[model samples]
Target: MSGSDETSQARALGEALATLRRERGLSQAEAGARIGMTSQGWGLYEAGKRSNLFRPDVQRRLTGALDATPEALVLQMGGEPASPEALPATGLSARGRVFDGAPLQTRRLRLETDELAPWASAGTVLEYVPGRWPRRGQGCVIQIDDGAQRVRLYDRADDAEVVVLGAGGLDRTERIARSRIQSMSAVTARFDDE
Candidate 1:
């Protein structure tokens, strides 16, 4: 394959692997350990920073770690299937979006109200989006205070939709109707954390 094809295939494989790890609720560090790699190294691999996807050993390790047959992962990574049996259905649609930006900016935020119980606690990591605000229930990482604060915002997509922020506990939920929202941004893609 050409260099471009190789790069594309590598990226696709990297994304697939990352998605699988997230769906399994394994952290990058944990997945790395399973594959005999350090957490940091696994992060790079998931980010497609390494260019050795074609290596036999790497392929073997990945298959073993993901509990998938080599042929299944390989075909999903852009290789043609040798036979119908070689391809296993992963059940995920190929139409999902991928996050292609740098690590999202995060900020400390407090719940502005009681409606967002157990979701957004004060001083939690709020992922931010600079200039784009999402519709209700769209699932966005919002950036406030000029990229200083970031948090995941659950969009309701209604004119009066409220935003939920925070991850742990039941006292962190906050609601901000669309009319009350000052500004926002949409989270186009994310690394699924299962």
Candidate 2:
């Protein structure tokens, strides 16, 4: 294949791999750790910067780490080549919708503590879109009326409160009163130290 064609194929394959990893509910760090790889190493594959997608062994290793098969990865890429516009965007998918015909802005914050360890540790940077509502199991930033901010895994929300998982792990759930929230935004991407 020509160089451009190779790049296109690699990009498509990377998108497929990313989709599989997300479906398995794993962060890139977690997914890479499963196969003894660094998050950056795994991210290169997902970013299509790695050129080994054409290798069967590489494909098997990647898919296997997600409890998937190479066949599944191929299927995820679809039966035919992807058009340029159909390729995945370079960063996290846009979550916030335009409001009153205006676009929302993306923001970033660094974690100062490991308050949400395992999912997000200290020194990790998170990208969030202010107007987007976080889905269950996704990360979110909650700014309270007291001017304190928290990063936690979203659980569920009710009319009165928003539920989240604390650093204590999955069984440790906390509910913050909606009245006390100054703002809440969905985290779109996480970048851990290499």
Candidate 3:
């Protein structure tokens, strides 16, 4: 091997952290102080001159001090960061990781039954946005009593209740009391196997 993976990761994280600190207009002393470290200590990490900088706790503490986040450094370390537009307005959020190594911005649900057929069939993967409300006539995932959620079309929703329709037709629908809904999300995309 050319070099240890841990060594390479440390160097990359250090460079990224340094860039992040500079972008925030903070000297190493100020940044370190916020995270309860010394200028020389922080500099070691920034210069890839220290090892503990790569630890998870250190990453969290240091990044938090810089008024940025580990996710920013994650991207800087050459890992993909989900698009800002796909993220929550005021908090950290990510759907999950995919095996193909591409960044994904939406939550996924696998269909187990053809009950919602035509719109989505069994084994189909549905992608949706958490904390997002569906537009009129859009598709969405509706949770029923904390069980596996179901994917259905948006019929209508009001403060007291939400009405979701299955693909069987407009005539087929279930009205869920707002209180009964464990959670709900807006379906943004769908995928099917070839």
Candidate 4:
């Protein structure tokens, strides 16, 4: 394509990406944070300064971070812009099929150490929902592919890593690579020993 045509197309793509992120109620930083990217890096994509946005892998990575699909982005580019009121307040949508009306998958983990003291001390049994993203400061269980499991407070996550606090105490923090994680679940409840 010609330089001017490429520029125009990039601009259109950037505008669509911006809309998708905004519809999700996320700032550039928040959206970028989900992928371990700097706000300026994300801004470059939105400003049409990044040419890699045209790559399929890049499109998937960026849109997935926004809980969106590249096809949705393209359809959105051709459709009318959404009104502010039309956007969901929380920007989170979940759906599931309940076989025999069964509850969602849940599991319990019993703390064995004071690693996460004050928040979830030893002898605490935690109930967590698999596949659910934890809100900031919430408790979560990180299970690695090698059979290692760690219970920690949720901090933040990016495409590459999950950051959690209180590995050994209230002050410790650990970052685990997403590649090593088998699954992550948000702690829904904690039952303390009597």
Candidate 5:
């Protein structure tokens, strides 16, 4: 691993932390509160400002605060960690399509409604991961039992219910019963040209 590798790794970790916090529907203040830290302090970690991100103690506290393990976070961070088992057969696409779980690989979708405008315009593209689950505030493409697919940003997901915020950022939301969903995937990348 070179300096660049380390830098990239830190960046990846920061992004993952931010995503996880959102996925769990916890605000920065909430996550920090769990660990006796301030939101600004937590922001530093999520901004990749701390070079000591891999330090054992730091990793432990952060993961513990999020109710996660180090290995799990690393896997969620994308790319291969020290442990390959973390990510498993799961993967992300980058070159339109790939099986190796390339980081930041983009999967594109075209929207038909301004229902997601300003942030997502009609005919613009949304890129996402087909295998990973969506985070709380991250965009997602979902397939309902009726086989109709739509995109929304997930706000909360539980055993019984899933609440999503969509339409230019939460102007409209859908609270659907989990039983009605046939499939769901995370949105990892986005390409909007509007």
Candidate 6:
């Protein structure tokens, strides 16, 4: 392709990437980290100022980072057709590793709090999936004390306690006795548009 054609393709691809990132609620820094770039680099790409758009390795990393198929990225870049399998899965199961590889096996539940009491409130909906205790110090959602309390669970192994950072910034720290923890999942999704 001509130089101008390449630049146009890069610009198209960049726009698609930016849209996908916004749709997925990822910050530029977060998306850049996933693709091995700094936020500034990502910004340049999104702005279509970067000339090198055909780097296979960069393309692959962008696909993986965006959880999109290679074909999709190609299409977004105004390239020829590619297959569906060439696209990556951006599902919860695939992205669950952010919570220490915990399997989110439970059905999704949505809850809203008027005040940011035990976690995030009112304007946000939280995804609840049940699983075992996550690695200590990692953030998770757990049902504590026989399911009586469900809150954002964080483990402080040094103190041998589990602390809950509730909505509205309420914190509950409790000793880590062997009581039933029910299950732990991640607050995978939250909305703060309000």
TM per candidate comes to: 0.39, 0.47, 0.43, 0.56, 0.47, 0.46
Instruction: Pick the winner on lDDT between candidates 2 and 4.
Output: 4
CA RMSD per model (angstroms): 14.4, 13.4, 15.8, 10.1, 9.3, 11.6
**Candidate 4, residues 1-194: lDDT per residue as tens digits?**
58897788788788889987875546789889888898999999998898887766787788988767766666556743234454334221112232132476789978989988788788999999875556668898878999998888888777778789987786988989988998777888999988
Residue pairs clashing, model 4: none
Misplaced by over 4 Å in model 6 are 75-80, 83-117, 120-194
lDDT of 1: 0.51
Residues 58-101, candidate 1: write the lDDT tens digits: 75677556545555454554444345443224321122233344
Model 5 — which ten-residue stretch has the worst lDDT?
90-99
lDDT of 5 at 141: 86
**Candidate 5, 64-138: lDDT as tens digits:** 666566655666665334543332232221112222535655477888887766667778778776645665677
- On the 0 to 100 scale, the lDDT of residue 157 in model 3 is 54
Candidate 3 per-residue C-alpha lDDT over 1-194 given as tens digits, one digit per residue, 9 for 90 to 100: 13475566567778889887765445788677665779999998987777666555667788877646778776655565557566444322223443243453578888777767777788888888764556556778877786857678777654467778884554598788878887667787889955
Evaluated at residue 151, the lDDT of candidate 4 is 85
> What C-alpha lDDT, on a 0 to 100 scale, does residue 121 get in candidate 2?
87
Which runs of model 4 end up more than 4 angstroms from their true locations?
A: 1-29, 35-59, 66-102
How good is model 4 by TM-score?
Answer: 0.56
Give, for candidate 4, the lowest lDDT window spanning 10 residues: 90-99
The global C-alpha lDDT for each of the candidates, from Candidate 1 onward, is 0.51, 0.75, 0.70, 0.76, 0.69, 0.52
The clash count for each model shown is: 31, 0, 0, 0, 6, 12
Which prediction has the highest lDDT against the true structure?
A: 4
Mind giving the per-residue lDDT tens digits that candidate 6 earns over 1-194? 57786666667777866765664445677667754689998888777676554454565666555555555555444454434444334210011112232344644444445433434555555554454333333345656666554555454322123445443454445554434554445555554545
Deviation from native of the Cα of residue 194 in model 1, angstroms: 28
